[model samples]
Target: MPSILLISDIHGNFPALQAICTQHPPEQFAHICNTGDCTVYAPYPNQTLDWLRTYQAISIRGNTDDKIIRLLKGQTFKKPGKKEKRIMYTSTAESLTSENSAYLLHLKKKQVLKLGSYSLGLFHGSPADHEEFLFDNTPEKRFQEIASTCKYDIIVTGHSHTPYHKIISGIHFINPGSVGRMFDGNPAASYAVLTIDEQARQKIQVQHFRCHYNTEEVVNELSRMKLPEIYGIMFKQGKKLN
Candidate 1:
């Protein structure tokens, strides 16, 4: 049996990623995949991207990543929403290095990976829409609709910052949650490990892990960068503000 690590919504919190690596190193997994949002909303954007590149994790473009790409290209929506404005104007976007910018630009919107006898569909959000919210409690009809659109044994997604696993129409759907900014009222960093046994008709096992890191250190880094103080509050509270 080999294990795969699924991570998403890094949001540039390097310490959280560091803690995850410390607990679940690359050697323990067959492959490490990221659902994206590698930057924005916290400090250490460059460091986070560097780590992802170094690990060579299979990744896809996230909504935050899309915003960065648009900013790099000097493009904006006709009527920018508050979230769009916040993401485009974040210090993290300003600090992204050219090398990392190129890295983000090359990311695909979705990835389908073949692992042994199983096929996995990976996306930042849903297969049809990258910004859509698909959570644990999403209606069964909605899952069925998504299922009708894609063919895969398992579908993995993120962007809601919530972790969940469910079987809809005999397909396994899992969200690994947020690696950096978690909104589940838990301050710990979150990720998931998936084990597939090729011998047992590709039996799947999913485990979610939460690693505690030094929140004060991250807060101090954000303060030093002179970013929004609300970000610091969000990190401490482990919930989104507004």
Candidate 2:
């Protein structure tokens, strides 16, 4: 059996990422897989990317990552009311080191990993769309539609910042939820552990873990950066503040 540590939506909170990694080191798992959205909405984008690079995490680009890439290419979000977002994305892009920027630029939108005797499909969202949200409450018909089209035995996705494990038509879908931000009403950082055993009748086991990190530290860092206070509040509250 191989133990895989699954994480996603880090969003630049180095302290939270560090706490999770400290609790569950990459070396302890068969693989440390990140579902992306690694940057944005917090401080320490560079540190977050550096940590991912150091661990050589299996990662794919998410929607916010795409925004950073586009910002690097001189394409700014021109929407009238998104000044804060524009600033946030631009600042994150500007903070990226050359190596990290190149890493983001070359990332594939999706990846397929062959683990043990099973194949896992990894995506920021669903296999067909990078920005789609497949949450726990997503209609069964939609999931069935995806399962019918998906070729992999297990489908791993992020971008919803919500965690869930579902089996539909003999296919396993797992989302480890958010590492930096939690939108499920609980503020604790989230990750998932997956074990696959070919000999067992059950074959697979998925568990979600929540590790509490220092949210005050993240809030202080955000304040030091002079970014929007809404993000700090979100960090404190574990959900998007409207």
lDDT against the true structure, each candidate: 0.86, 0.89
Show model 2 residue runs off by greater than 4 Å: 79-81
**lDDT of model 2 at residue 185?**
71
Which candidate tops lDDT? 2
Residue-level lDDT of model 1, residues 1-242, one tens digit each, is 87999999988889999999899997788888999898887788899999888888999988888878887787764424775347424566678889898898899999999988889999988988898999888888999999988889899999998898888888899999899999978878999999999677648989988999888888999788666677788888899875
State TM-scores per candidate: 0.94, 0.96
**Which window of ten consecutive residues has the lowest lDDT sum in model 2?**
76-85
- Return the clash pairs for model 2, or none: none
| Candidate 2 accuracy as lDDT | 0.89
